[model samples]
Target: MNSLSAFHRPLGSTGLQVSPLGLGTVKLGRNQGVKYPNGFELPDDRQASALLDLARDLGINLLDTAPAYGISEQRLGPLLRGQRQHWVICTKVGEEFENGHSAFDFSARHTRFSVERSLQRLETDYLDLVLVHSNGDDQTVLDDQVYPTLAQLKREGLIRAYGFSGKTVEGGIRALEQGDCAMVTYNLNEQAERPVLDFALSHNKGILIKKALASGHLCLHGEDPVAKGLELVFAHPAVGSAIIGTINPHHLEQNVATAIEVLGR
Candidate 1:
């Protein structure tokens, strides 16, 4: 097993590489209505900067945030600051949450607008990856103007890669056939998304595992369900990375160490 400081892998054929454990930032911005077992106070700018510094110290290079995740993109902009080149930023389009409700727009216009807005919010000229934040209608969103718009953005050098964080296997496959990555949910309690992971691996498409700890629910009553969950997730040859969003530095370090132990990186 290798330490988190030694884990870096290619992201399919996008010409970009990332660490085996990408840091997710949902908890950083949104706290109005979250599903985490415990309540949390949103971190101030200083704390967020420290967290980024810690993640960098731990050798984490990939960051997963989305426009829909409250002000995560905006917050990261200033925090990342001069060190922006050190991280692979993976953000999303198609959905927005405000006043405790989510509204989705998969239109070509909205997709392009969203990417431009994300770039502005992140204070970056280009994005490493941009995924379609599906509204559970994965196929429909893919079939709509969103995917094509992203493809165009890629051609124009606005985004390096495009992907789908979908809700179904059918949609996951569709996303892969297009030669982009898919963020699927796979954990001890829910394995229904295994087929999606398998497809991505067999076809050489990138696979980023979301909810690897079942969105923080897996540790509710377990001796250590997270270790068990990540052990299973990184064992597969096709597993590219696992996005774990932990606000606590200790928890983040432990998760990375556990992955290092499991994958023998």
Candidate 2:
């Protein structure tokens, strides 16, 4: 098996390429006191920004963040200001939060407002991709509000592509069948979404795997679980990238090195 660093795949048919291992910034912002087995500390804004710079330096180009992740967009946006062209800045809407609690708000107006807010926060004119951040089982949100708003954004040139983030396999398949989304992020370790991954592969939709290590659960019981789990996902013909979060540059370097070794790049 190849090391984790060897994986770089195209994100859908959008012509945007990304490392198979991308940086997920949710934990970088505020983990909300969530504990990881590695005892990893969540980095503050300065530290997170530095980590992002280092990740980019290491050849990780895709950075995923969400408005729901308290101040993540607010923090990541500024750090990414001048390097917009060098990386894929992907953010999400439909989820809102205050005081660390989150709620779904997929209304068209909210979606529009969210994009504007993200642009303002990130200090960028356009986002590479805007995902409908659904918590699974929100078909009404996808059918009625999410797609329509994203369509408008694409028409207006505010976003390059749009897709959905599913917490369940059924929801992922539903998004793929709808035929408007360019990519989808599905949970790989759960294995509940393999059929969805297969469907996405058949349709040529971009597939990004999330929780590939089951939020570090897999890592706790084994050595280099992130490396192993990512290898499995990258081997899957459908997967385009895997988004993993870590505040440690050492860990991030390990991820990139593993990819380079595994993918033979």
Candidate 3:
């Protein structure tokens, strides 16, 4: 298959096809130092806008963001107004940011409000995908509020698909068991999530690999360690896509080239 075709994969049973390499927008919104290394301050709006344009031009169709990412959806939505239809905009609910810290809020009412607010910020009538952002605890939240709320949104057509962006392997596994979720994002460097990856693959769940470079530590010593690590993850039969955050368009293009080279190998 060609690079674009290789990049495209089924997002669970949602029937949505997205690129294998996605753009993570937290850095673009000026929320750094959370999950990434050397996370220093983010770039200004003009630079972020240029990066988004570059990503689209390079065929990146999935853009992952979260409300906790501090003004990401608000800024990205307006910049992507003309090209919104060309990409899959993925955002999360259940995690809120205050004072630059993230907190979980999975109450049914809060979940509903989060989705609605995300829609408003994104300037879209419906979300391409909505994930319940979990911080490794509160499995009950998924059972009690998240699942039902997501189902309701899907039924109402306010969301095309829903899933979990979890911090733990067990939480991800549980989310997959619901069988209604369209995709799951998990830390790939930690083997703890391997079982969840297997389950998702077996069931055809959309699998997006996060932290594939282990928060930039994989290549800390240089020599393209991150590229090698990503090669392994992409070769895995289960992983559908990997989200890499970078401020420079040249770095993005280099990573894409590396992925293409590794896939060919």
Candidate 4:
């Protein structure tokens, strides 16, 4: 019940196993244009490296990063050098952030280029997972060439699996039908995506829950809201992993402990 690795589960039928909690690296790479309840500073290389070390020791293997997360992908490359096999990296394409602004490119060319760039930045020959970073218009983004390009990459051995980080129920279902997984926002404050989780459960597809703590906003309420929120997230059978974006080592440890307790029960 204490070791997170012991609770690792299959990510649908992707043949890849991930811990109950994945580390989300947005705060490690970017601090601007975020929706957290409070402001924070980016961690230095030493601090970030230590955080990764702690995460590994706690038995978390899934690391979620993206091009839109400022220089997160780039920083993770150097920080995670020589330890690539110890982790399951899940990155995204389609969305890119620059000058504090965001842009979307779901075209076939960009999708292909993004995968290669992510490979270069992560210092890996192949990526464990690649998701299409939807621009809130989930259905429209899926209708583009992004999904098909990811499929091609998967077949080419560039990526082990591909999916969509979408915002809609229909999009999540469509993603699972066409790919291996879907990342959706499922937290205490948001249950609008429950249908997506239901579909994933019925279809036996992978589902990654984003904003499980409501970007830390849920903590503003009653006691131990983080624990309550995590309880709600892990209560679902479809959740392959819940991505928690905590840069604080103490917070990370507490989150993992809470998850172990929840999963144990």
Candidate 5:
């Protein structure tokens, strides 16, 4: 199969192009309080760099990270030095990870602070995209305070686009109504947020899929569950990219190949 770069598509109305799959970097920062099917040690710098090289060679350009993912942003900052233009970096605000726990703050002040911190952590003057990390209270998270703050940041050119990584279908719809994109969970095991995807498709907004492989829990005693799961996700034309968090090089290659095969690129 060819590289995914050949199939890059517009990320809604954001004026940015992205790959069909994004690399989720939660494993690069924290190995604690996760739901992965297998335990893994955090890769060292050399190993992490090698994985990134493999991802770029595979034509994956989108990178998903968040402050709630421990030090993922911190690590990516140095790792991505001098190659910022090649990536469509998507990070989050409103949630923080510390002491093996997660905390949420959607206030305007914290929102600005979080964005600035991410800029510094990512070692970039501008972020390609910034998403609000929802604490499950989607309505409250889409409140006037934090959402507007992100909009202001976009206007100020600190971020190219802004949206919410929401938990509810209603919140996902509302987020797209006021922002550039919305991240939702849609997979074989869960379709509760399918309405959100439909809205994005109808409205020409961006949709990023989380837990596309059910966070690595969809492995069944059958033939190629990964391919089956990816087939279901790619069935939605609104899906801008599905974030896969696998750190294994072989799995990454397989996923890229599967995406290429599914899309027939």
Candidate 6:
């Protein structure tokens, strides 16, 4: 896209080659109580479209969204139309945000309903990937019939791959063992979850690095903490991609450049 060095790789054994960086859409929808050091107004349609175009131009093909991400799904439904072919959309199930609180429903019926709603909202017949948005009780959710429901959806062709965006090392590993991918945090401030990536590498399951920059907190001191964080995550052979949400096009471009540098074509 932007004449950047190539840095695409396979997402586990899913047969889909994806960019090493994914654009997270939480910022595109929600701005309340965000963890960023600075706050900004939500982008309107024109700005959102331009941002997506810029991401594509920068060789970022992955987009991460969730129902809990405020109006993200509804907003992207139209914004992503006609450009769906170029993105690997990864939306979530099991968590819904309303009136400033999160609620979980991972039952088979609700899971099916959520998938249907996501498909409708995203204006797509199918999703490239889906992750269980754990409410910190990762194992309990899986045990309470979330994973099985998603597995059924995979068989039904609603999602190409399914995994867990887990909060614990054990839960992440368990998700990988049973599912196609595991989204975990692996930044400079946190290395306790590195075992999850190791397990994914050994088991050939996909590993998506969440909070690779600690949700923007990592940039507080260093001149290039984003680059430093990406270097740390991409150094691991297990990492499939790092999902970073930023409305700033310059930051996205800089991130892509940093990723290519760390990955080294």
Candidate 6 colliding pairs: none
lDDT for each residue of candidate 6 in 1-265, tens digit (9 for 90 to 100) = 4533267889999876788899999988988766788888999999999999898888889999999999999999999889888889999999998888889998889888999999999999999999999998888988977889899999999899999998999899889889999999899999999999999999898989899999888754646898788888988999989999999998898888778776773
Model 1 compared with the native: what TM-score? 0.96
Better of 1 and 2 by lDDT: 1
Each candidate's TM vs. the true structure? 0.96, 0.89, 0.91, 0.97, 0.98, 0.96
- Candidate 3 vs candidate 4: which has greater TM-score? 4
lDDT of 3 by residue, 1-265 (tens): 2244456777777777887788988876655447655646677778888888777777688899999888888888788887878889889988888786778878789989999999989898989888888776737666667778888989999999888877666778788877334234344346667777888878877778877767666643556776677767887777767888788778788877777777667
Q: Is candidate 4 or candidate 6 better by TM-score?
A: 4
Model 6, CA-based lDDT: 0.89
Superposed Cα deviation of residue 228, candidate 6 (Å): 1.1
Angstrom error at residue 24, model 6: 0.4
lDDT for each residue of candidate 5 in 83-102, tens digit (9 for 90 to 100): 99899999999989899889
Model 2 ranges with Cα > 4 A deviation: 1-7, 33-42, 179-189, 219-223
Model 1: lDDT equals 0.87
Please give the distance, in angstroms, between residue 96's alpha carbon in candidate 6 and its true position after superposition.
0.4
lDDT per residue (tens digit) for residues 1-265 in model 2: 2233234567767577877787888776666744466555567768877888788778788888989877888887777767888888888998887786878888889899999999999889999888888867656666667777887998899998788887666677787776434334443356767887888878877777777767777733545676667667777787878888788788788777776766663
Model 5: how far residue 54 lies from native, Å:
0.7
lDDT of 4: 0.92
Candidate 2 lDDT (Cα, 0 to 1): 0.75
Sequence-dependent TM-score of model 4: 0.97
Question: What 10-residue stretch in candidate 3 is worst by lDDT?
Answer: 179-188
lDDT of 4 at 207: 90
lDDT of 4 by residue, 153-253 (tens): 99999999999998888888888999999999998889998998898898888999999988887854457887898889989999999999999999998
What is model 4's C-alpha RMSD? 1.2
Candidates 1 and 3 compared by TM-score, better number: 1
